[model samples]
Target: MAVVDVALAGRSYRVRVGAGLLDVAHCEAHAFIEPYGMRSIPIVADANAKRLLGERLQASFRSAGHAIDWYEVTPGEGSKSWAELERLTDWLLTRGITRSDHVFALGGGVVGDLVGFACAILKRGCGFVQLPTTLLAQVDSSVGGKTAINASAGKNLIGAFHQPSLVLADTSCLATLPPREMRAGLAEVFKYGLLGDAEFFARVDESSEAILACDDGVLETTIAHCVGMKARIVAEDERETKDARALLNLGHTFGHALEAETGFGDRLLHGEAVALGMVLAARFSARRDLISLADAENVADALARAGLPTEISALGLDCDGAALADHMRHDKKAGGGTIPFILLRKLGEAYVARDVSLADVAAFMDEQLQAH
Candidate 1:
């Protein structure tokens, strides 16, 4: 087991990475909630996750002398809506949940994002534990303090920066994940390599099979390495004030736009959208001569090899480059007239650039769609 510390001044917490940590007699969750002096806990889980690891977590927390209440949201991207948040909060209040209580988000990115944001605004603010079940959530969303909910305007338009008290990433939970979901998660794993650590990206190239196979050792190493990378970056810049943390959004700008254009529904999972977004970012960088054409090809190849979507047209999306670019303008990262995009200089090196003209982005996207 490896423990990575997310140093955030007075609110620092540890991310414990290991296999079977969830079944180890309150190993991870206890260490996190005990410090908060919380006795009552409300667990917000997705239906699929509840069918898988929810019982074990509930049993462990109950056995640890904490009163437990559970809430299950339907599994999918649609669950991150204001209506769902309101319903869950009402459920909690009916159960007599107070600000002193904590919430345990026990699912993938959607569950973590919605539940974390719910806890953030519930009675002002409350502690929450991130027991990220999916690979995407474990390595990315679970570690970052950015919690959000989707609105009529766009995805993640309404949210807060509420940090989790602890993050428990049990590799075992990924065993039952569908192949598509596993592939979706690989996008974030690739993002870590693209954003920083060229060496890590190389390792991912070599270990893509072992990772997708859910090999315990490889999975453990990959999750801890990514967590450590994010922990260091987030500790230094919690609110993304500096560009330090924006690197984490290497493919997110384009990714979020695709999600919004697609209605933020099951048509595209967040990770899948990011997978395509990364390839587009790489291609756009190449178009600008920031990187070579080979770099763009390499990114596309890596994502395709990992079984993730590498082209927008391949997703069966009916939208065009102009429509997609229109969604980008509404992005929270958009400022003054340009959307800040994290583009790669090469694998493992990413930087935010606000100078990218929307016309060029649309043209590049059109080229990819035509090629597909």
Candidate 2:
């Protein structure tokens, strides 16, 4: 088992990465969860996850003498909505959850975001544990404490920064993930390398096959490295008050717009959009002469080889560049009449550029959309 400490000043937590961390047969899952002091565990999982892993999870808790009161959420981005949030919060209230009682979010990013946000506002903030069952959640969303749901305005606009008490990423869960979902998660895996760790990026590129094959050693190591990088960044800037945390948004700005254009559904998974968004960021940086064209291609090549879309043109959107840029205007990051972009100075080097022109971005996107 590998542990990465997210050493937030007073509220530090550990992210445990390994196979069977969630299995009570190992006793580790129950041990870490027992201290929370809830006799009957309140767990919220997506419907699909419940169908697949729920029995095992329930048995694990049962073996530790804790009964589970499970809440099932519908799967997909739609679950991260106003209606769902209201429903989940009501359910948690009915369960009599207290600030001291930790709620367990046992599924992928959607389940985590929904439960985390519910815990954030439930009685003005409660504790929760992340049992992230997906690679994207394990390596990125689960550790950061950025809980959010989609609003009429934009994605994650309605959310909060409430860190979890603990995060258990069971690598064994990846075996059940669809190939597309796994590939989408790889975009985030690639982001860590592209934004700050060149060596990690190269390692991912080199071991892409093993990773796709779910090589346990490689997958666990990869997850730990990404979590370690995120832990350092979160500890440094937990509130995005500084540039360190903002660096984690390397491809999010552009990616969110693409997601918005696609209606935030299966049409483009969050990770897939980030993959293309990162490619666009690299290419845009090259256009601005911040990075070389060759470097931009290398970035695209890495993602493309991993089975992610590297071109905006491939999405087949009816709207043009200006429309996509308009979606970004509603982004939560937009302030002071301009949006900040996370552009590459070079591969493994990203910096915020607040001076970015939406019009210029529209034109650049237009060119790409027209490209074959």
Candidate 3:
């Protein structure tokens, strides 16, 4: 197993990545819940994951002598809402879940975020474990402590910074993910390179095929590397108090806008929105003379090669730049009446800039839409 440690002073934890890790009794999973001395454990999972990987996790904890309760949330972004959160919390309460018990998030990013946020407020903050089953969750959402539920205003508008005690990413579970979901997850994996690490970007460029083919070795190595990068950053800045953690939101500002504009439905998956956001960020950097157009094209080309969406026009999205800009205003990074963006200086280097004018962003969005 490949282990990456997220050093958060008092809240440090380990992210274990490996194929078939989920089937090996999951001692780590059991320990995360048991260490808290929680009275009962709630395993929150998507319906599909419940059958695929959740069952194994349940059995693993059961064998470890812990009482396990299970809850199934519908799959997709629609599941992250106040209504769903309230319902899940009610179910937990009905099951006699106490503040002493930890909730186990047993699916992808959505599951992790929702469950983690629910645990954060339930009984003044219960603990939770992250058993991310998707690549996106494994590398991005699962590692970071940013847990949230979506509101009608925007994506992740109502959320909290609740860290998980353990993050277990079993590569084998990814095998059952749909092709589109897999491709969506790659957007986040690619972000680690685009935001910083040109060499990692090049490595991903070379290993794109191997990754898509789901080669166990390549997948394990890729996940470990991404997790390592995130762990170090999270350790340095558990919250976005400093710009250190904001770097992780390289393309998220724009990505979240796109997601919100589409109502966080299937119109564009989070990864698809992120992929396009990266392309837009790169292009905007070049348009502003911060980076060469060639570099921007390289970013787009790399995303294209990875089978990710490289343009907004192709998505058949109904909104225009003005609408997208409106959505940007609702982004979490929007503070003091300005949306902070993490723009690239070049491949493998990104900097947060609040000075980016909305007009400039709008013009770039218009150009991208026209190009498509």
* Candidate number achieving the greatest lDDT relative to the actual structure: 2
- lDDT by residue for model 2 over 51-162, one digit each (tens)? 8888888888877777888899988999999999999999888877778788889899999999999999999999988999888999999998999999877899999999
Candidate 3: where is the Cα deviation over 4 Å? 33-40, 65-67
The best candidate by TM-score is 2
lDDT-better candidate, 1 vs 3: 3
TM-score of 2: 0.97
Candidate 2 residue pairs in backbone clash: none
- Report the poorest 10 consecutive residues by lDDT, candidate 2: 24-33
Candidate ranking (TM-score, best to worst): 2, 3, 1
Supply the global lDDT for candidate 1.
0.84
- Clash pairs, model 1 backbone: none
Stretches off by above 4 angstroms in model 1 are: 25-27, 31-40, 65-67
Candidates ranked by lDDT, best first?
2, 3, 1
